[model samples]
Target chain A: MSLISVGEIQAAAQRIRPYVLCTPLIPAPWGDRDRPLFLKPEGLQSVGAFKVRGAFNAIGRLDAATRARGVVAYSSGNHAQAVACAAARFGIVAHIVMPRETPQVKIEATRAHGAEVVLCEPGRREAVAAEVVERTGGVLIPPFDHPDVIAGQGTIGLEIAEDLPEVASVIVPVSGGGLASGIGTAIRALAPAATVFGAEPELAADTAASLAAGHRVDWSIEDRNRTIADGLRSQPSALTFAHLRQVLDGVITVSENEIRDAVREIALRANLVAEPSGAVALAAYRRGATPPGPTVVIVSGGNVELGMLAQILTG
Target chain B: MSLISVGEIQAAAQRIRPYVLCTPLIPAPWGDRDRPLFLKPEGLQSVGAFKVRGAFNAIGRLDAATRARGVVAYSSGNHAQAVACAAARFGIVAHIVMPRETPQVKIEATRAHGAEVVLCEPGRREAVAAEVVERTGGVLIPPFDHPDVIAGQGTIGLEIAEDLPEVASVIVPVSGGGLASGIGTAIRALAPAATVFGAEPELAADTAASLAAGHRVDWSIEDRNRTIADGLRSQPSALTFAHLRQVLDGVITVSENEIRDAVREIALRANLVAEPSGAVALAAYRRGATPPGPTVVIVSGGNVELGMLAQILTG
Candidate 1:
C-alpha cells in the first residue's frame, strides 16, 4: 500500500487552514525534566477533537457537485460531530449514522450542527450509513480509513515538526490508526530523526497486538469496548495499518489506571481537560515509555462527558 | 498617571516571544450563537496564568548589570510561580515572598522553578518582600504596579486585535487591573471601535465601584478575601487604575455562583480549565452585559485547587 506523501498532508493543511485552528504547542513543564514535553491540544479545536481536521479535509476535497450532494459518516463519537460541523461550515448536508444507545447529549450535539442523524441498532451503524449513502447519493466519509482523512490529520504532524524542529519523539493515541498514521507520516518526512510512537489503553491494545504479530489483527467489538478510552475501540483499517507499519517506531499500551491518573494530572497541573482517549499519550510518557529528549504529545481530543471528567478528577 | 502604550506592548511581545506561548484564541461555539465567543486561554502558559507575560516583560527589560543582581516579588498565587519561572529562564536569582498560610503545592511549585521562597505572616508579604529586596539588592517586580508589567500584560490585547481585528468587545478579569489595563489599552489603540470591559466577582467588585464613583475605591482585604476568586482580591494600583479608567468601556460584576458556573462551563464545553477569576469574563458575557458581535474573553488563569475545581465541576 502506498503511504500518504508529505505533499498531500501539506495540501490538506492548506485546505483546512481557513476552517481549523492552529492549536499552539503548549509547553508542559510538568513532565520529566530529562524529557521536556509539549502538548498539541487538538481538543482546543472547535469540535473538541482532531477529527475535524480529517472531516474538513475529506469534505473539502470532494468535487463541487458531489460535495453539494453532501456527505455521510457513521460514528457515535467525535467523528459524528466533526463531519456534522465540517459539512455545516461548507453549507452541505451531513447524514450521520449513530448507534441508538448513544447518549442524548451526543445526538443533540450532532443535530445542533444541522446534521441529519440516522439512529440504528448497535453494531449496525455501517449498514445503516451505507443505506443512508444509497438513499441520499452522498459520499461516505469514513472516520479514519480514507487517504484524505489521514492526510488531513497529518497536518498536526506538520505543525509539530514546524513548531519544534528539535522534537526527538512524538506520541499519539491509536484508535482506527488514522491519527497516528497521518502524524507519523508527516514526522517521518519532515522530522525524520524524530521517533513516532502510538499509545492506546491496554484494555483495547489491538494495534499493539497487530504490530507485534507483524500483521493486521482483529479484536471483537465487545472486547475493544472494555477500555475506558472509548475512542480507541476500533481496530485499524488496512490503509491505516499499512501507514502505521511504515511510520511507527513502537506501540505503547497504558493501563486504565494510568490513563485516569494522566487525565487528572493534565487537568490539575496543565489546566487542560483531557478525555481518557486523549490522555493516553501523556499516560505513556508518564510510564517512561518515550525516549529521553524533547517530546511532543498529541492531546488528541477532549469531548469527555462532565460526569466522567469529575469522576476521573476525584478518582 | 500614564497608560501603557501599544508600542510598549509590541516591544514586550517581541521580548517574551521565546518564553511564552502565543495561546490561540479558541473558538467556543458552545456560547450564544449570535454573539460568537472566543477564549484566550492564558492558563496554557507554563506557569498556568497570564502573569508570566508581565513577569517575563518586567525581568527582560532590566539592564544587564541590574538584572544580574536578581529580582524579588511577593505573591502566594500565580505571580510567584511566574516570577520564579521567568527568573530561572533568565538565569537570575528570584526571591518570592509568600504568606505562611499559602498551600504547600504553590510554594513547592515556586521553589521547583529554582526560586528562593521566603514565607511570611499573612499581612507581611509585601514588607517581607521589601526586606528581601533590601538585603539582596534585587529589583522589586510588583505584581501589577510596574509600567513594564502592564505593558507585558497588554500584549494579550495586541494579539486579540491582530487575530480578530473585527472583535466587537474584549472582556478581562480585573484584580490589581494590570491585565485589564494592559489589554484594554491595546484594544483601545488598535481596535478602537472594540469596547473593552472588565469583569470581576461581585464579592470583589471594587473596580466596578471605583469606575462608578469616578475614582479609585479601596475595599478592605478582609472583605475582598471573601470570594473564591482569590486572584481578584487585590485592588488596582494607581497606575493600573489610570489605564483602566482611560481604556475601559464598562465593568461587569458577576456573582460567585456565576463565576463558578462559568468555570464549569468553560471546562466542560471549551475543554480548557479556567480558575474562578479567569471565568469571570465568561460569566459577565453570559449575563449579556457586552454589545452583540464577536466577543473575546481572556481566561486569565487556571490555578484553582483541585478540590475547589472538583466542587465547582460537581456543583
Candidate 2:
C-alpha cells in the first residue's frame, strides 16, 4: 500500500481550512524548561477534537453524488462527533454507529449534530456500521484505516512544523494509530531530525507490543477496554501499522494513574481541558522517556463527560 | 487624555509577537444559532491571561537602562503573573505587590516566575507597590492605567477584526477598563460597525453604573468585594474611563450565579477552562441582551483554583 504523500497532506490542509480551526500552539512556560514545551491543542477544534480534520477531509473529497448519498462512521467518541459535524456542515445526512458502552456525552453530541446514531453492543460497532452503509447507500468513513483520513490528520503535523520549525520531538496519542501515522509521516517528510513518539495507555499497549514484535498485534477487547482512555481501545489496521512502523521513533506506554493526573494537570496548569485519551501524550512526555529540546505534544481531543472530568479534577 | 490609537495597538502587536500566543478564534457550533458565537481564549496565553500582551508590550518598549533598573506592579491576580513572566523573559527584576486576600494560586504563580511578591492589605496594594518602586528605584507598571498596557491589550481586538471581519458584536470582561478601552478602540477603528460591550458582575458593576451616569463612578470596596470574580473588582481609571466613554456601545451586568454558570458552561461546552472573571463576557452573552449577529466573547483568563473549578464543575 502506498503511504500518504506530503502533497496530499498539504492539499487536505487547504480543503479543511474553512471547515476546521487551525488551533494555536500554546506555549507552556511551566513545562519542562530544559526541553521547553508547546501544546498543539487540537482539542480547541470544532467538535472539540482533531478528528474533525480527517472527517472533513474524507467527506469533502467525495464526489458530489457520493457525498449527497451521505457518509457512515463508527467511533467510541470523538470521531463520531467529527463525522456528524462534518456531514452537517455539508448539509448531508450522516449515519454514525457508536458502541452502547460509549460515554453518553459522546452519543448525545453525535446526535446533536443531526446525525442518525445507531448504538450496538460492545465490540460490534464496525459490523453495525458496515450494515448501516449498505442500508443507507452511504460511503463508510473508517475512523483511521483510510488514506484520506490519514492525510487529513497529517495536517496537524504540517501545522506543528510550520509553527515550530525547531521542534525537536513530537509526541502523539496512538490508538488505532491513524493520528500518529499521519503526524509521523508529516514530521518525517518535513522535519526529519525531529523524533516522533507514539503515546499509549499501558492497558491498551498493543502498538507498543506490535512495534517491538515487528508485526501487528491485537489485545482482546476486554483488555483494551480496561483503560479509562476509551478512545484508545481500537488496535491499528495493517495500513496504519505500516505507516506507524516507518515513522515512529518509539512508543511510550503510560499508566492509568498517569493519564488521570495529566488530565488534571492540563486543566490546572495549561488552562485547557483534555479527556484522558487526549492527555496520553502529555503523560508520556512527563515520564521523561523522550529526548527533548523543544517538544510538541498533540492534545488530540476534549469531548470528555463533564462529570468524569470533575471527578478527575477532584482527585 | 488621548485615547489609545490603532497605530499604537498595531505597533504593540508587532512588538509582542515573539512573546505572546496569537490565540485562535474558536468556533462554537452549540452557541446561539441566530447570532453565532466565537471565543477568543486568552486563557491559553503563556501567563494564562490577556494581561501578558500588555505586560510584554510595556516591558519590551522600555529603554535598556530603564528596563535593567527593574519593574514594580500591583495586581490582584493575572497582571502580576503577566508582569513577572515578561520581566523574567527580559532578564530583569520584577517586584509584585498583591493583596493579602488574593488567591494563593495567583501568588504562587507570580513567585514561580521568579518575581518578588509582597503581600499588602486589600486597599493598600497601590501604596505598597509605590514603596517597592521607591525602594528599588524601579519603574512602576500599574496594571491597566498606562497607555502601553492598554495598547497591548488592544492587540486582541486587532486579531478579532483580522480573523472575523464581519463580527457584529464584541464583549470583554471589564475590571479597570483598560482591556475594554483598548479593544474598543481597535474595534472602532478597524471593525467600525461592530458594537463593543463591557461585561461586569452585577456585584461589581461600577462600569455599568458609571456609563449610566456619564462619568466614572466609584463603588465602595466592600460592595465590589462581594463578587466571586476577584479579577473584576477594580474600577476604571480616568484615562480608561475617557476611552470607555468614546468606544463602548454598552455595558452588561451579570449576576454572581450567572458568572459561576458561565465558567462551568465554558469548561463543559468549549472544552476550555475559564475563571469566574474570564467567563463574565460569556455570561453577558448568555443573558440574551446583545443584538443577534456574529458575536465574539473574550475569555479573559483561566487562573481559577483547581479546587474551585472542581466544585463549580460538580455543580
Give the CA lDDT, 0 to 100, for residue B78 in model 2.
97
**Model 1's interface RMSD:** 1.0
Candidate 2 docks with a DockQ of 0.83
lDDT of 1 by residue, A1-315 (tens): 888899999999999999999889988988888899899998899888999999999999998998999899998778999999999999998999999877565688789899999999988999999999999999999999999999999999999999999999999999999999999999999999999999989999999999999998888888887899887888899999999999999999999999999998889788998989999999998878677899999998888877778888888
Per-residue error for B203 in candidate 2, Å, reads 0.5
lDDT for each residue of candidate 1 in B234-310, tens digit (9 for 90 to 100): 89988999988899999999999999999988987888999888899999999987888999999999987777788
The true-versus-predicted C-alpha distance at residue A5 of model 2, in Å, is 1.6
Against the true structure, whose TM-score is highest? 2
Alpha-carbon DockQ of candidate 1: 0.78
- lDDT by residue (B118-167, candidate 2, tens digit) is 99999999999989988999989889999999999999999999999999
- CA displacement after TM-score superposition, residue A270 of candidate 2 (Å): 1.0
